[model samples]
Target: MKKFLQKYSEFMRGRYGVDDLFYFLMISTLILGLFPNFLLKNGLGLIRWLLFGFGIFRYLSKNFTARSKENAWFMKVFRPVKKEIKFLYTRIRNIKTYRYRRCPKCHQQLRLPVRKGKHTVVCPSCRHEFEVNIRF
Candidate 1:
């Protein structure tokens, strides 16, 4: 029994660690405890308060201790790097290539080639065909 308990603890530590699993369990218990009965009766407005409390607890747990400080540092570094990479990708490539023209019949946005002069554009939404005055 003790051997099995030790092995389970080791596995949990390897998989998610003590803090993460504790937070997950706490949130899960709160959700499961309130979801079936209280959620239907009170709706999302009341559940949002519970969610806010969970958020506050999670924020405190991830900012108030040494281990949490390491997690916070990792999150801070990771998010900015990811965002900068995304920004660089967007800046390097032209997203204006996917610019659309509004249909004359239904006024729905239609994807057309980015070129100068008039062109026959078709709107898939309204199945309307019209000539677009494109100036590039």
Candidate 2:
């Protein structure tokens, strides 16, 4: 096993192995292939296989620069989506205890403690102040 791993690592020296795009492709493939629609299933099945095959090809290919560029581009598109999902998840987790607000100037999300009556809210990111009544 040690010998095999060493050999495999050596074989993959100049190749681009795993990256964020690879994981995203894999997860998207699994999700798209999970639905029950026959047409969608077949189409997504092909897409999934293509993505998997492409990832494997990338892993074995020695074109490291192009593969790295592709991964960077994918991350440029994927980070915001990931952040939004995380924000939603945290908001849901703290739904009853806190309220989520966005700063009008900077569009930054703020988590305020839930309370009754009127209060002034400050946007930490932009240093903008605003007032809101938390009647919950």
Candidate 3:
């Protein structure tokens, strides 16, 4: 077991091995695999296999620089979507206690306590004061 582990580590020494893009490909492949055949035709199966193959290729590739660039590009493309999903989750979790609002001047998101009626709110980012009517 110890010899096998050492050999595996040596084999993977210069490989690109496991990254966000690899995980994304693997997870997408799994999700596609879970889809019913009736819902999605045979084309998705081909795509799933391709994704899985690509993910494995990435994991074992010796071209570290190329793999890093690909992962960087993937992250750049995915960052905004990830941020929005996190923001949505946070908003849902704090739905009862906080109300999320965007500051008009700076367009910054503000988390305000759940207070009913009209009130004056100040933007911490731009130091802009605005009146808000929270009728909940």
Best by lDDT: 3
Model 1 per-residue lDDT at 37: 65
List of clashing residue pairs for candidate 3: none
TM-score of each: 0.29, 0.74, 0.82
Query: Candidate 3's C-alpha lDDT?
Result: 0.91
Candidate 2, number of clashes: 0
Report the alpha-carbon TM-score of model 2 versus the true structure. 0.74
Q: After superposition, how far is residue 61 of candidate 2 from its true place, in Å?
A: 1.6
Query: Candidate 1, 36: how far from true, in Å?
Result: 47
| Model 2, span 1-136: residue lDDT tens | 9999999888878777888887877777677667638636466556767877887787677888998999899899889999999988998999899998888889998889998889899898889999878887
Candidate 3 ranges beyond 4 A from true positions: 129-136
| All candidates: CA RMSD (Å) | 15.1, 3.1, 2.3
State the lDDT of candidate 3 residue by residue for 2-94, as single tens digits. Answer: 999999999999898999999999999888867859436655567778889999999999999999999999999999999999999999999
What are the runs in model 2 whose C-alpha is more than 4 Å off? 36-42, 116-136
lDDT agreement with native, every candidate: 0.61, 0.82, 0.91
Best by TM-score: 3
User: Where does candidate 2 have its weakest 10-residue lDDT segment?
Assistant: 36-45
What residue pairs clash in candidate 1, if any at all? Answer: none
Look at candidate 1 and tell me the lDDT of residue 86. Answer: 86
